[model samples]
Target: MYEQISHSLLNEILDELQPNAYERRRDLQHFYTRLGANFYAIHNLFERLYGQRDDFELQMQRLVETLVRKYMHRPRELKDLDIAREKDHNWFLSQKWVGMALYSAGFAGNLRNMAAKTPYFQELGINLVHIMPILKCPVGKSDGGYAVSNFREIDERIGTLEDLQTIADEFGKRDILLVLDVVVNHTSDEHEWAQKAIAGDKKYQDYYYIFDNREIPDMYEQSMPEIFPESSPGNFTWNETMQKWVMTVFHNYQWDLNYSNPAVFIEMIDVILFWINQGADIIRLDAVAFLWKKIGTTCQNEREAHLLLQLMKDCCQVVAPGALFIAEAIVAPVEIIKYFGEDAIIAKECEIAYNATFMALLWDAIATQNCKLLTQGLKSLPGKLERATWLNYVRCHDDIGLGYDDNDIRAAGYDPFAHRQFLIDFYTGSYPGSFASGVPFMRNDKTGDARISGSLASLAGLEKAAQSGNEQEIRIAIDKILLLHNLIMAFGGIPLLYYGDEIGTFNDYSYRDDHDKLGDSRWIHRPTIDWQRVELRKRQGTIEYTLFAALKKMIAIRKETTAFADFNNRHLIDTNNEHLFAFMRFDHNRSSKSVLVVSNFSAEPQTLDLQTLAHEGFGTSGQLIDLYSGQQPVIEEGRLPIQPFHFYWLSEY
Candidate 1:
């Protein structure tokens, strides 16, 4: 019955569409077929959220029209790519796909220059490059390009859209995947829609959550927590021009969209498709957790927000089935897994999501010199849908938030509050015997909460070691860096490397001198690439050369290891040594092909009893070889000793 209703509505929408679109639809019979298959689910989802509104049918027509237009705009090459991806739907799950996230301008001066430097990424065995947000945004007011003034236009400081197309073209030839950001939650006040809203245009005002007064805003503030307490103090900001209180969850200038309005949903869907047409293989939906707002709720990770994502994903499938979505939801482990969609097998919302739990747990292990909480946290993390995978990384273009579960912390034999405070102090160099040189960010005075910010090298103790000219300390830091990278590479997902971490770049304190960046400590890690420093990778014995060479080798080995593919084949091993984090990975098709990954997180050596893993075919193995170093671990008294900050990928042929 619902299918008939959806088809009837689609027919009406098709008839009302322009003649050009109709002609193009005939050329795209596949598009028509896909629309026919998915429109029912789309319609049901849309109606579920907006059926009570008077403009329900009209909004439905507009939504279908948006999908049709974008489908027509998609180039023939992209359509062909879509068809190819459809045939191999699980292509992204391959072990060969290693990713790196970076800013175009910061990495190579501009889009064109970045394209010219494609060999740099290829050299590091990176085939998935996530260029950070480059859309047009207000100068000085842009939250690092997340506050988009214009969705379609590229930021002038970066190159033009044509340059981005060039990147897509060039990267395509290299078989590289291009990932782009779509800031779906909010837009800059300088945007045309916001401008009209401020000018008292009723239609534009409906695009955002602009309230007449503070009555409803006050109700929302009661439940909603402040995101950036030190910088952006409140959830509501007063706009004097319209005498309205607007929802500014992140910052005052960035107005949150009213998802209750179907028009807003249609507009964002159009923006997403436009970028997909421009050559984004993967679209990272920014701040997906904050899409829906409700009174007496945290306004994050709501059910309606998941429905919105599902709708957006369905629309994209009809237009470009190959394009994958990455949910950038950095909430708790339980909440974050939902972004992968609540399906028994296949993911209905996003194909990929950030493994923030794993990332933060890695940091916790580094700080505490143990895997107690890391192991406990992994146990508590909900298993994702089979079709989805994790985007694992140590750091990105954001501050590190200790959003660990208190239960897991307690299970690890530590007080949650005191443990978190210790991590904060250790990273900021305030704790005794700390080697990290990170800075505190967005410290909430009321809640005694704060996040740490710094480059990976700085946080791993390279900065202090280099500053003090301690060669021994520098080697330890380098080992620590490699140890972190090794886990992510072998950790059942696509390991995302940040731009400068491969070459051991330190935090740039110069961000503090910039007027626009002074308030944000995250910018300290977003440093401009020193090509001169990058050149050091060619020189042996240099820190850059050592780190880059080791990482490149690991990436190559990871690509060759069939067991490294993400098929939910990872099993955590009980080592009984708190300093050792151990897990086993097996090829999903051939369980006999397996690797045992074990790492020592402490400064002191640790031993793993081979007897514990004897039942899993380890102690009686016929010559266990380390795939990483191609060496054999000497087992004495049924125990394997591991050096400080070292790891091994043990396998038996």
Candidate 2:
């Protein structure tokens, strides 16, 4: 790490530091040590990114100053927490942590009320809370708070920054982790920088991709696929005030930041550290794949983007080493793995990533009533870095895109295009005998592409069954709900539950009335929680009570299972039964502590041959216990019968 070039440059930069900064460094011994330890790698990455610029040294000096300022502003309690996390680096990779993602306003009224609902999370056994975006943005063009008009200020519609601090304080006392979002990809056109650009500030104009005419935009549009093809249609939106075109990959109001400029990179880094100082344990970088763009390429998953992420990570390490990052890149499996960094042993970029492929595959099994594609797709999922893990979930505040690979679809004995279309139709209730009540989102007319949007309960037939008043159908619907929860709970990662899924909350049709939300069908699943309906969770025989009790039991069991800790210890078993999906999770240190998870996706009873898992320590003579049920599985004649839409967490007793 102490290469001559990097060390010499570091020494030069240290000598050139201002008098106040030099004195501050002397007082902050730990900061000085961390900066020294990380400076070589930081310099190397920064040099790789901006080495050719004339103001390279100036930018390097600015980056270090930003780190020092943020470190100084970090609270004393957080500093102690950081040191503790540093001592226990792999603390997050534990079975004890369960996460729930919710909007502050939807879950409770605001940040203050959300803080008071700590008991609600505790009652459900959740210790990690991902409060979706609460930043200031334009009223109608917020894109669900993804478009930020002010990076440092909290939205007035929500509570103030002080209210957020209160939640952090209260959650810290209850030993809960707070995950916040940093929309790193773009900002609202109403942002200060964008306004300056509109005001003819040439320097600010350089911050975004502003064009004089359609020539450059036309060239870029050839390779850049439309994100919102139906609504936004194209990648470039013409600005009347500036008489120029700006690149708007998501929506016209969200202007993509030009990462080709080092200043822009430095500014975003400062913004990330700003949130870390605001008591965010983990920062989810939104739309990370589109960070760096090129004219001729797809402008996604570019090499420069990865380098920029690496640089941001190195800087974060220097200031807040304990704080973690979650990459929100929902791309292909191969490309998504790189967000964990290409390191062999350690995750240098992001410590966590959304297991989107697993999510999509789970839905595939639900629609097809088989695990063929789910098995094949997972087999194709690349192994993650040893230190990195996944954030497994059944649903979130977004639409589900069936981004399965064509080869995996073909291997599962289905046509790629036709299979995707079937999923769209089946979930939208357009296919025959389909019980799902999902709506279509972002349907591209030119390409015939679309995504599905609905709550887990609605998509699993609970809504339709309840409406039909069929007892048998309702029971099967609840079974399907628990079956999906069982898989994510035992899967090798921190299982994330959506806000109202625990009580089987249905899709809200009210979004159709709000003009801003009418166009986005994903809002159907982002329903406001009805406390009155939530009270039904305590009333016996109600659907809410049944779901809440089952999910709570599963979460408790998941925490107690030591093998559920994520260390890349899951093995996908070939059940050879199309209607059945099976996998084994084992503790890397103690292989004897293993659990075999088996689920039946069909409506008919299916038998699993015990001999198939004989090598997994389930022999004919031993007793096999289902951890969730706390009873011995009924295995007769070397076969275990699983009831329809049921699952078991079996272990040798």
Candidate 3:
């Protein structure tokens, strides 16, 4: 990428990197070195994005200056961390990093109060905490803080900026990683820029896609699919004040930013660096797939979007190298992998992305009571870049979209559309003999596409079992919950536990009474934290105690087991029993140490032939112990017996 003209321009800019007498250029050399290494790529990306603009050189200079200013603002401790991380780039891909995703308001009422629950996280072996978006927004139609009104200000109702800093300081002391959200895709209409645009500010109006009429929006909508057909039906909404149509890919209140505008990109980069300077170890880039738009296309997972992310990563490298970006793009599995960038040994875009495919496949197994689809789905999922990892979770703050590939569905010997409909019916309790008690979200009447909305426990049948007062069903539900937990923990990634899932929190129907929340069924799963109910984790024999204790034990074991590290060394073994799914995890360092994970999805006992598993080097005569129960599995002759809804993390002593 030796562009003579660009290189000369960059050299000239560096020559002009003069500082005032009062300014100390401490670590300015490190910043300059990084800038030199990354500027070529950054310049190329910027030229491609805004080369036609008249102020292209000015914008490039502004981008470079923004990085230097942010680097100066970064704390000394963070700078030291950056140097340490530079030495060990793969530090985050370790087995010890178990994560928990929680809303700051629900977890402990506020930022300062959340510090009191640090011991709770420590006791559960959670070292990474993803605090859901807490930025300032309109109270009622905030879209759960994704519609960020202000990038720098914390939502006062949740806590002040000082409170967040205090909690981050506390977390740092305990070796815990604090993750926050940066809603990079869009902003609330109440945002200052949006307000200015509403007031006929032509400069701010260019920040978003605003049209005088629906002609262009109509063309864009011809290809852009509806995100929330039940609520916001179109991609563009007409603003009465401005008398113009503004592009809003999610909700009308959230205006999509035009990344084509270099100024907007520069502003977002500053916003991201601002959070990193405020002690955020990881910033989740929310809705990254929809960042770039093009007419006659889906406007998702586009090439330009990736270039934007690469530029952001390069800029962050010049500033806070210790901070990492999580690509919050829940797109197709193939597209999701690209978010990690196509680098051979390093991630240039993002270091982590959500394993949405795995989450959907796990739910498919729950619905079908078989592992055929789950196995097929995983086989098709592309392996991510070596330096990047997945944030694997059973459920999050969002509803579960069945985004499975049709090809995988057909490979599992089922009709793609029919199977999806069956899943919806079963989970919503409309199908006969359905055990799940869940609700449907964003049901598109035209396309017949719907997503399931419910807490993990509710979707696993705990709510239905409790309602029926069935002891056997309750036990089965608890086993199912543990079985899913076992897989995610032993899965080749950082397993993120939703806040209340460990305690078997069920769906809260009370959201229906709130006018602001009733429209979004996702609120059903986001119940307020009940401390009184959380105390049940201490009472033996209670469902809460059982789930909490088992998860705690598994989390501890996962931290200790080197075999569970995310090294992309997992190999699936065909048990020939449709109800049983098995995978082998070998230590990346020690070839002799391995763990064979087998889970039965059916409600009946299943058997696996040791002879068949011998192909995977697991048929040896060594004693097979279940790590969860710490007892030898029942083996008759050569077959291992797995109880109904039971999973065994089998390892040899």
What are the clashing pairs of model 2? Answer: none
Tens-place lDDT per residue, model 1, 255-290, is: 999999999999999999999999999999999999
Between candidates 1 and 3, the TM-score winner? 1
User: How many pairs in model 3 have backbone atoms within 3 A of each other, for residues 3 or more apart or on separate chains, i.e. clashes?
Assistant: 0
Model 3: lDDT equals 0.91
lDDT per residue for candidate 2 within 291-405, as digits (tens), equals 9989999999999899889888988987888899999999999999999998897888999999999999999999999999999999999999989999999899999999999
lDDT of 1 at 89: 86
lDDT of each: 0.94, 0.91, 0.91
lDDT of 3 by residue, 1-653 (tens): 46678888887765566666215755677777777777888898899999999999989888887887788888889899999999999899898999999998878988879988999999888999999999999989799889999999999999988988898898999999999999999999999999999999999999999999999999999999889999999899999999999999999999999999999999999999999998999999999999999999999998999999998998898898899999999999889999999798688999999999999999999888899999999999988878889999999999999999999999999999999999999999899999888999999877788999999999999998988899999999999999898999998989999999999999989999999998999999887889898999999989889899989999998988889988787898888999999999999888547999999999889899988987677748578888778998788989998889999888987
In terms of lDDT, the poorest run of 10 residues in model 2 is: 19-28
CA RMSD per model (angstroms): 1.2, 1.3, 1.4
